[model samples]
Structures are given as C-alpha cells and as structure tokens.
Target: MRTKSEARKDAIMSVALEVFREVGFDAASMSQIAARVGGSKATLYNYFSSKEELLLEAMLHSAEQHAENVLQLLQTEGDFSQQLHSFVASLLTLVNAPETVEILRVAISVGGTTDVGRRFYESGTQHVWTEISSKLQEEIKKGSLRDVDADRMAMHLRCLCEAEMIRNLLGAHQRMSASEAREKADCIIDIFLHAYGSTR
Candidate 1:
C-alpha cells in the first residue's frame, strides 16, 4: 500500500500532466496546476519547488515506472523472440498512455533553445535509450540476441519502436493488437540476427 504522501504526490503529478498537456510546460503556471489539484499555489510549491522541477519530476516518474515494468518483464522466463515480444509490449504500453503522450508533447514544446529543457531532453528522455541499450546488452549476454554494440542497436530499436508509438499517438494505431506488435518484434529480431546473430 502506498503512504498518503506518495499517493498525494501521484495525484498531483496526474493533475499536472493534464494541465501541462493542455497548456504546455512553460505556458502552464503553478497556480494552474494547484487549482487543477484542488490546492493553493503555496501548497503546490511545498511539493514541487518550481514548474520546471514539477515537469522534470513528472516525466522522470513515468520513466522510472516504465523501467521497473520492463525489468519485471525481463525477469520472466522466455526465449529470444518471446523476450523481444515482451519488451515491445512493455514499451508500447507505456508510450501509448494518453497521459504519457501528453507529457511528451509538453516536453517537446519546451524546444531545444533553453538550457533546462535541453538538459531534460538529453539526460531525462534520452536516458531511456541508454536504459534500453543496457537491456539489449543483458539480453545479448543471455544469448537472446546477437552480439552487437548495444548502444547502436538500442538507437535503431528506438527508431523502430518510436515510429510506431508516435503513430499510435496520432490515432493511426489502436494499441496495435498484441499479435501485430509481436510480429513487429519478430521482424526486428530477424533484422538483428541478420546483422549479428550467431552463425553455426
């Protein structure tokens, strides 16, 4: 069970995500988030120091939750294709969330001009690619994938998966039937194998 404080923090983040999505990060004020959360500005400040902090906190919160979910999936026993399917499914589920999609929109809205947003872009969201690369390395060590530079492999995987994710956000995909996602995973696995799969 979550403590009250933890629950409250999640609630605030959920509310903030909505406000941030509707108005974007810079345009959305702390007072707006506070009102959306049914609190006053001062109380909201007590939880998040500033709008930038709140934005970073919420995005990181989503990413941390996703990383844990993927870790759990990796823990379950599966063959290479199955493991890849699991990974794709997990990634799809997280990025497909409406709240998550909206949070992403606001993050991009910040653009690359500002230092704070740029740092968040590079270290925050960009860290996801690194995490995926780490997972790719783990899978390779387990003989689930062909040996390759996990960093480069992860970059390509991100491109493939993110294309689908972005389409889903645009309403061009409807969560992709599990079978469809699995097929996509299998295709990517085939490509990976062609490049680096062990040849007997």
Candidate 2:
C-alpha cells in the first residue's frame, strides 16, 4: 500500500536514473530530469533536495531492487557451498550489469566532489556486506565454515567476488557469459571454502 507521495517519488527517481544514465552526473540537470518526468523542478525538489540527493536516491533505488534478488540466493536452502556459489553467481550478474557499472562509475566520478560516493558506499555496499556477514555467521554457527570472524570473512568473499569488477567497469573486457559467471562463482567459493570450510 504505497502512498501517492511515495509512488510519485519513485517515478521521479526512475526518470532521474534514466537522465543520469544518459548525461551522467555532472552534465545532468534537475530541469532535465523534471522535464523528462513531466513535472516541474519544484516538484522534484519537493521529493529531493538537490540533484546529488536525487542521484543518490535513484542509484540506491535501483540497487535495492537488484540486491533483493541477490540476497535471496543466499538463503539457507542448501549446503553452505551451494548458498555461496549461488550468491556469488547472482552477485556477479548484478555487478556486471550495465546499469550497475554505470552507477558505480557515476558514483566514483563524484566521489571526491560530493558525499554521495561515500554515502552510497555506506548505505549500499556496506549494507549488502552486512547482510552477507550475517549469512556467513550463520554458517559458522552451523559448523559449515571455520570459526573465524564472520564479518572479515564476508569482506574477503566480497573482495574475491568483485575481483574483476574494476576491469568490467573500465571496459577492459567483455561482459561474462552465464557459464563464465557461474564458473567464476565456483572458483570464488572454492577459494573461500579452502580457507574457511570447517575441517570437521
């Protein structure tokens, strides 16, 4: 039961994402987004204080939608290995997605100039890692993973899963195929398990 205000805000954010993607952060203007949304600049302002704020919210909105699916792959439906592999595969798909890579680039470009980058890191990336850490902690409690620091392990897992992300973002290589993504996920899980898999 979303309120009209909430729905309107989401519509604005969706249009804002398109504007950001087309012209990027610096070149994008509130007027441009407002026009695209068929609303006045004042309307957009009512929902978001500034273009930076709107950009952050838009990227977060997109990320949240994608993150929900990825998070679901980490469910406790199977063994820890199955969970990790599925999670990593889905994560690879998400990160390598064109929309996501563009958002990362936009965030990085504005990182020094504004707080949106850091805020996105805190609210988006860190939040996802926290969710991952919780899953790793559960595995540890079940003796499926070693009794190491779950948070640290989750960080390591994230690092490994995203090892090639920079290259993908930079266009150094092509987007991986589904088979390739799954293979990479398997390799990442293998490495993680080698280190953390309980010897018991």
Highest-scoring model, lDDT: 2
Name the regions of candidate 1 deviating beyond 4 angstroms.
1-3, 165-175
Of candidate 2, the 10-residue stretch with the lowest lDDT total is 168-177
All models: lDDT? 0.73, 0.87
lDDT by residue for model 2 over 57-128, one digit each (tens)?
988888788888889988758777887888899888778777777778888889899999999889988898
- Candidate 2 Cα outliers beyond 4 Å, as residue runs: none
What TM-score would each prediction reach against the true structure?
Answer: 0.80, 0.96
Whole-model alpha-carbon lDDT for candidate 2: 0.87
Cα lDDT of model 1 by residue, 1-200, tens digit? 99988898898987887788887777889888888888899987888887877887877776677777775665577675567667776676666666667677677666674455576667666886787778778878877667779999878777766766667556565655567766777776667667756564
Roughly what TM-score does model 1 have, to 2 decimal places? Answer: 0.80
Task: Find the 10 residues in a row with the least total lDDT in model 1.
Answer: 168-177
